[model samples]
Target: MRRLLVPLVLVLSVGGSLGGCGWAGRHAETSKPDVFQLQGYVSVGGAASGVPGTPCLAPTSVPDVVAGATVRAADADGKVIAVSSLDSGVLAQASDGFRCNFAFRMKNLSGSRPSYQILVGDRPAQTFQTRELTEGKPAVVTVTASS
Candidate 1:
C-alpha cells in the first residue's frame, strides 16, 4: 500500500505543475491586447505664411497652431487613453496659401475602443472610427486654423 501511495503522490504533483503552467500562459495572453501604434499629421491652414528662415509658432503657444503641441487620444466615453507631442512644423505651400504640417505618433493604443477622439492643444477634438485607423497604417488629418 505504501509503495502504491508514493507513486500516486508523485504523479499528481507533476500533473498539477504542468496544468498550472498551461493556465498561466493562457491567462497572460487574455489579460491584454497586442500593442498598437497610431500615427497622424496635423495641418494648420488659413494662417500667414512664414518664410523658410522664420521660426514656426508652436501649437501650444498659439491658439490654433498645432506644431509642437500635445496630442491626446481619447476613447468614446471621452477618457484619454494615449498622449503624444507633435513634431516641429514643416512649411508647405497649399493651394489656398500656406500650411504648417506637424507629424505625431502615439503608441501602445488599445484596440478595444470603438472610436478615438484626437485633440491638439486647445483646439476642437476630431473623431475617428476604429476602421479608419489600422494597426500599422498612418492616418493623415487636416486641421484648419487661422493665425
Candidate 2:
C-alpha cells in the first residue's frame, strides 16, 4: 500500500508540471501581432460595346460605374468589422478601355477568413471572400451588375 501511494503521487506531480508548461507556451505564441490591414480594389463591369442595331456582345470592360458603392468586411459571425466607399474619380475613369480600379481599405483585421461585399444602389450585392487578397498588396475584386 505504501509503495503504490508513493508512485501515484510522483506521477501526478509530473503530469501537473507538464500541463503547466504547455499552457505557458501557448500564451507566448499568442503574443505576436495578429491584426492587419485589409486593402483591395472593387470594379463593377459589364458588356460595354454591342452591335449598333443588333444584339452583339463586346469585350469585357469597366464602363458600368457602380456609384454609391460601399465595401464591407464581415467576420465568421457576420459582424461588420470595416468599411469603405468608392471615390467619384475612380468611378468616372475606372475603365481604361479595359479594367477600372476602385480602392478600398479596412484596418485592424484579425487576418482570418473574412467575407467581402460590394453594396451598390438597388443592385444585387456582389459578395466574396478575402482569402485571395495577398498581404501588403491590394486585392482586385470585380463585380458585375445583374441584368
Candidate 3:
C-alpha cells in the first residue's frame, strides 16, 4: 500500500504542475473574445492631423458633422461584434479633433493573433490585429464624403 501511494502522489504532483503551467498553451487563447474599448477619430475628407485646424476648415469639423457615419468591427468569422454610430453620446470633440469612439466587444475570436475588419462609414474598411488595437491607442479611420 505504501509503494502504490508514493507513485500515485508523484504522478498527481507532476500532473498538477503541468496543468498549472498552462498545458497545451490553451490558457492564452480566450474562450470568447474579450470586450475592449476602441476609440478613434473619424473625419470626413481626410484623417485627423492632431493639429487644431481653423474654424470652418476643410476636413475637421464639429462632432455632429459625422453624426450620420457608423463604425463596425467584424471578427475573422465575419461576425459583427460591435456597431457604433456617430449619433448621440458616441461623438465628441477633443482639443485635437472630433472623435467617434466606442466600446468594441469581440466574439467568435480565437488563435494567438486575432484580427478584425474596421469599417468606417463609406470609406474602405481597415484590418487590424487585436494587439494593435489595445486600450489608449485608438485606430484612426478616415472617409471621403460627397457633397
The best-first sequence of candidates by TM-score reads: 1, 2, 3
Kindly list the per-residue Cα lDDT of model 2 for residues 1-147, writing each as its tens digit.
999999999999987896775543455564644566777766544445333232322123433344336766665565666777654424222343323345667777775566555443333454556654535656566655455
Which ten-residue region of model 2 has the weakest summed lDDT? 50-59
- CA-lDDT, candidates in order: 0.72, 0.54, 0.54
In candidate 1, what are the lDDT values of residues 1-147, reduced to their tens digit? 999999999999987896775543455465545456888878766545777434454344356454556888998878899888888777777788766677899887877777789887777788887655765556566775533
TM-score of each model, paired residue for residue: 0.64, 0.47, 0.45
Which stretches of candidate 2 lie above 4 Å from their native place? 1-30, 46-68, 89-97, 114-134, 145-147
Best by lDDT: 1
- Backbone steric clashes in candidate 1, count: 0
lDDT order, best first, reads 1, 3, 2
Candidate 1: where are CA atoms >4 Å away? Answer: 1-27, 47-67, 135-137
Pairs that clash in candidate 2: 94-100
Model 3 alpha-carbon drift over 4 Å, by segment: 1-33, 46-65, 87-113, 144-147
Tens digits of per-residue lDDT, candidate 3, 28-123, equal: 775634445666555444333443343322244333345445678777765676777653224345555554333233333332447767776545
